[model samples]
Target: MPSKYRNFRSSVPWIILFLEVVLIILFYFLFSDDDDASGSTNSYPAFQDVNHMVIFGFGFFLTFLKRYGFSSTGFNLLIIVLGVQCSVLIEDLLVLLLQREYKDGLQRITKAAVSMTAVVISTGAVLGKANPVQLILMAVVEIIAFHMSRSINTTFLQVSDNISMMHVHLFGAYFGLAVSSHFSEPSPRTEKNASTPKSDLLSMLGTLFLWVFWPSFNSVLLVEEKTKAIYNTYFALAVSAVTAFVLSLLTAKDGKFRMTDIHSAVLAGGVTVGYAAHIIEYPWIAMILGLLASGTAVLGSYCLQRCLHPALKIHDTSGIHFTFGLPGVLGALAQVVLLVLKDWTKSPRLDYLVMIPIGAFCLTISVALITGFLTGVIVNLKLFKTIPVSKYFEDQFYWEFPHLAVGF
Candidate 1:
């Protein structure tokens, strides 16, 4: 291929990457100035609401990316990181917009309708092969996990617990569904009967809508407090994405891993940084941590997919290998590394050290096991068994499309 045309063809994706980096940097600078003016003597919660909303929204979006058309394995990986960033940031911005009061009944109705509409649309869009009832249960479990964090005394520990718990909940829900889809009583439908997974065109068409808006998700509120951390994340993501892109081509399963997975490092790095985004002072440490995180996430996901799943003969693609599982682990590791570094460099506090990981792990495990087991049992009993668990809600439309066959 001629360099000119090739560049022309690739220019769009490159430009999109450039714009995403620029936006993240721009946001960082804006926040950094505020932080500098405020000085290090003062510290706030680091704009958490914005971060939580963004992560939640993005995580939710990734679950349905295949249906939206970016089903290529590689692209889907990248979508995981990018989608989380985009959804969280956009949701954060929306919440900001919603904070304003409106006196007119018409405006109130419009806002209410818009908010409710978004919840409905987002839910419907992602449900795919999932039953609406199961989806509701999943959401309920997630909410319970969220409230559990409130009981913790330390803010840092609370945040960490929330991150870990939410992931476990997600893993439990998806894994439970995958298991039920396979082993549970004769459902008229199963994974084998699923509608062909759609290539998520929305991902390719938009060229990482979330990546471009990365800053909105990361530091919209605490840009000032964590300016350096914010910049580090963006800088790392840019480098990681380029690296992933080149490697993705070399490792392509035709289109299985999609070019997006090339940037898998970005998500791992982002999640790793997410833990210390507010207070990590050492630039060198942050850089090294981010780089190591990327490698770990990629390798970890691969090992889990190959060694663990096949051994069990469990083809739950949405479980430990994907969705929130690996990302959550990466997040936990990041916390550990940051904490270790702090303890080594500063005074060691054994009590706090022991509490962080133990507390997080225990909470996550309790929630996941309880939720997953119960959900599995419920689904196995043939109650609410009509729910869709495949990619297209194929079961629901089966009557209209008689040719569609389900399996165990």
Candidate 2:
């Protein structure tokens, strides 16, 4: 890299920080006087859990790469902070412009966290291939697209998805995959992309955090059916974890568990039950969804990922498609099934219930792909610093570390 390019790359974080400070000032002036903007105290605990998942769970989960632990956790924090602020501002501005009202503070923050969760999930797909500058750029654009797609899903399509099945998981997965496609190189997988035993252990800690707190994520926005949502999410997660272990044993060559499969497939139930978390009245139904999600996730991780890399030339660094994409689609299907079964006779808008989820599913994919590809183009432009293929998945490219830090 040229001296000028290095200088520019070094200044990117400062530039983003300055802009975020300015936005914070603008937000204070815009919403300071509105008494109703502050939300209820009751939501604090759930918000805390979701925040933990977004920060710690996601940050640690991406640290499975041997040489990229610092970048994984550090960039995860950076992208999340940027995504949250941008998402909240965009959502508030949109609501104020269209609805003549602002969302309450806790609600806005909670939703923003959820929105950023999608962005973080997307980050997993392009993890080692993109620079921090590129990731920040991608996140800002993604936040805007995320809110727009969500509005189209909820307001226009009237999708009954309460847990952001299509809006968050599916959209994030495909968007990231599309961006990964754009970032793909002809080079084959390298040793740096593989995880160390310590790193895998750290990543599994993340999995446990996500596994424990996911019910709160699924039920955070619900009121009437909060308990039901929690219950369903728990049942589904339990089944998925067991099923993931079983599949890992069956699929591995020596009957040993692959930590990669455990890291992702164990969480399949949470993504799978998201669509109907609040509405799945039976534990059996949730468990069935869990089983299916685990199978699909394991299959995609073990088999489909290899084929996808060559056929589509998309390098999914953390198997986001298996963890979030396929399971998300299954969740959407589960939503459709539940809606049809429950509303077929009682509700006159059965068609809306059935078709809206499907429409939202399709719409999310379209929006995510178009926006993601466009963002990829912008980030890949000569204006920004790009991660060279040789430097991919290595933290020393971006991080300043003392000798002692590497001793462990």
Candidate 3:
């Protein structure tokens, strides 16, 4: 990379931070009205749990790389901070333009946090490969695409995804994979890509946080049947965790559990169950979804991921394709089935029950792939600093290693 470009890249964060401050100031003055002030306080508790999942759960989860612990957690935090601001501005602008109203307080902040969740999942797909500036750029563009796709689903398609499974998990996974596909290079394995016992333990802590609070994530935005959503999520996650452990042992060559499988596959139930959380009235049904989700995730981790690199040239760093992508699609399909079965005789517009979810599913993929590819193109342009292949997963590229100093 040229020195000019390196200098420019270093200034990008400062520029963005300044712009965020300005935008936030403008937002407060321009959109701060009585309606915004009167936003409900009921959602605060759920907001706290979901916020924790975003900041801590996702931040630590990506620290599995042996040499990239600092960048993993640091970039996660940076992306979320940028993502939340951009999400809030875009969502509020969309609401004002379409509905002729303003939104604020815990409601919009919670929604922004949820939107950033998708960005974080996408970040997982390209974790060690991209620079901080590129990641920030990706978050801004992805947030815009997210709101657009969401509007299309809710307003035009009339889709009812109470937990945003399709819009968040499915979209995020595919988008990140698409970006990864664009950034893919054929390089031999390196120590930087490997994990240590300590790193894996830290990553497991993140997974545990996500698993415990996933019920809150699924039920946060619901006005009714919150208990049902929470119960279904908990039931599904419990089953998924047990299934993940058993399957990990079965799938391994030495018949032992893999930390990676436990890290992601155990949370498959949370992602898969959200699509139909409100509709599934039976615990057995939630358990079935859990079993299917864990199986799909474990198989994808064990089987499909290997094939993906060779076949499609997609190097999913965190295996988001299996954990979020495939399981999310399964959740969407499950919702389709429940929608048809449960609403077959009751609803007048039965066509919507089938068409909306399917359409939203297809639309989410199209938007994610297109936007992600475009973002990848922009990130790879000569204007930004390029990461050398040798430094791909090494924290020394971006972080200080004081312990390595002879004087120290």
Candidate 4:
């Protein structure tokens, strides 16, 4: 970094910031046109919702660790901004190849927002272990992979509705898990990975923020069904939150509550019903999804966090496999089933409608898994090796902590 840009004490990674500025300038001046001038300022509210999800939701959601708060939130801030900045260029290029049109810079920004949401989820899976540079690399590669899979699903596969189910959640979850699986093993779950009361409070705040705004998150692109989307997503989120609270104790040994439930299960509603949040006309369906999704996610978290990882020797820090992966799968499957059911009510043939989402699901999982694994392998190569094992989850190595962080 140049002397002028340096913060003296804090390591700002100014080069990345400079690149971000250049990318934002290019997105507006380059991809958009003065002649067409098509866009709706009406979409600004939804744009804000997406921005919060990326900037605040993902950042705090990963801040559940005690010592990793700085890395979790700071690195998140850095990578997501970069992800969104780069996504505009990448998504616009994909759209042009398909001869599609976008309204304006604001709408393009919302699209970029969802792209960042996907990248942040992947970052959560590999949280606390990756350096800022590695995370930047991960964000760039994951954004490209997310776009390719999402573009294919929307275009060639014609999988309509539940865009987040297949594109954002499933791809991000699996990709991050695949990457984390190859990263160095977890250091013992010491204070290094543990959360303090303050951190838990921060995590809850993130959870509530995501829970409250999720209705808007899923409803952003709804043309005529915005109200239905809002109602279903809202109801589903409520049901899931209550269910996660109850089941967190019921499922735990000695009937004690677990932090994992608070961290992951409560938000299953947003994930499980996301695809059909607008499509489903009934609140009952939404409630059923929330109940089932959160319940299943917690149980999966229990198994993966306790049994499966111990048995298999795979390292997952935040239990991404359950929180994101299981819910994503359930949501995608439910969406496909609903799509077919909706088609059956209107049309005679079920085969064609059923196969499309199923195929997209299969294709997306394969692409995410393969691409994610390869990305992980590349990062693990000598060229991009991660930090030392002893220093895996702590942030003092990367960031200058407060109150004389270095001398302490």
Q: Write the per-residue lDDT of candidate 2 for residues 1-408, one digit (tens) a residue.
A: 468647866788697888788878968855532435235567778889999999999999889999999999999998888788777788778777777465467777887898887799899988989887788888888888988888877778866436443359988998998888888562665778788999999999999999999999998878889999999999999999999999999999998988888898999999989888888878999999999999999988867667766688788889899999999988888888988998899988877767777888889889999998888888888777676788788887777768847894
Superposition-based RMSD of candidate 3 using all C-alpha atoms, in angstroms: 2.2
lDDT of 1 by residue, 335-374 (tens): 6666677685565686677576767655654554465456
> For candidate 4, which ten residues in a row score worst on lDDT?
1-10
Off by over 4 Å in 3: 1-9, 28-30, 33-39, 161-166
User: Could you tell me which 10 consecutive residues in candidate 2 have the lowest summed lDDT?
Assistant: 31-40
**Model 4, 402: alpha-carbon shift in Å?**
4.6
| 1 versus 4: better lDDT goes to | 4
Give me the runs in candidate 2 sitting further than 4 Å from their true place: 1-5, 32-39, 160-166, 404-408
Task: Show model 1 residue runs off by greater than 4 Å.
Answer: 1-128, 149-198, 204-207, 220-224, 253-257, 263-266, 317-320, 387-408
Candidate 1 lDDT score relative to the true structure: 0.42
- After superposing candidate 4 on the true structure, give the runs of residues whose Cα lies further than 4 Å from its correct spot: 1-18, 21-29, 33-39, 161-166, 405-408
Each model's total of backbone clashes = 18, 0, 0, 1
| Each prediction's TM-score versus the true structure | 0.56, 0.94, 0.94, 0.91
Candidates 3 and 4 compared: the better one by lDDT is: 3
Cα-lDDT of candidate 3? 0.85
lDDT of the candidates, in the order given: 0.42, 0.84, 0.85, 0.79
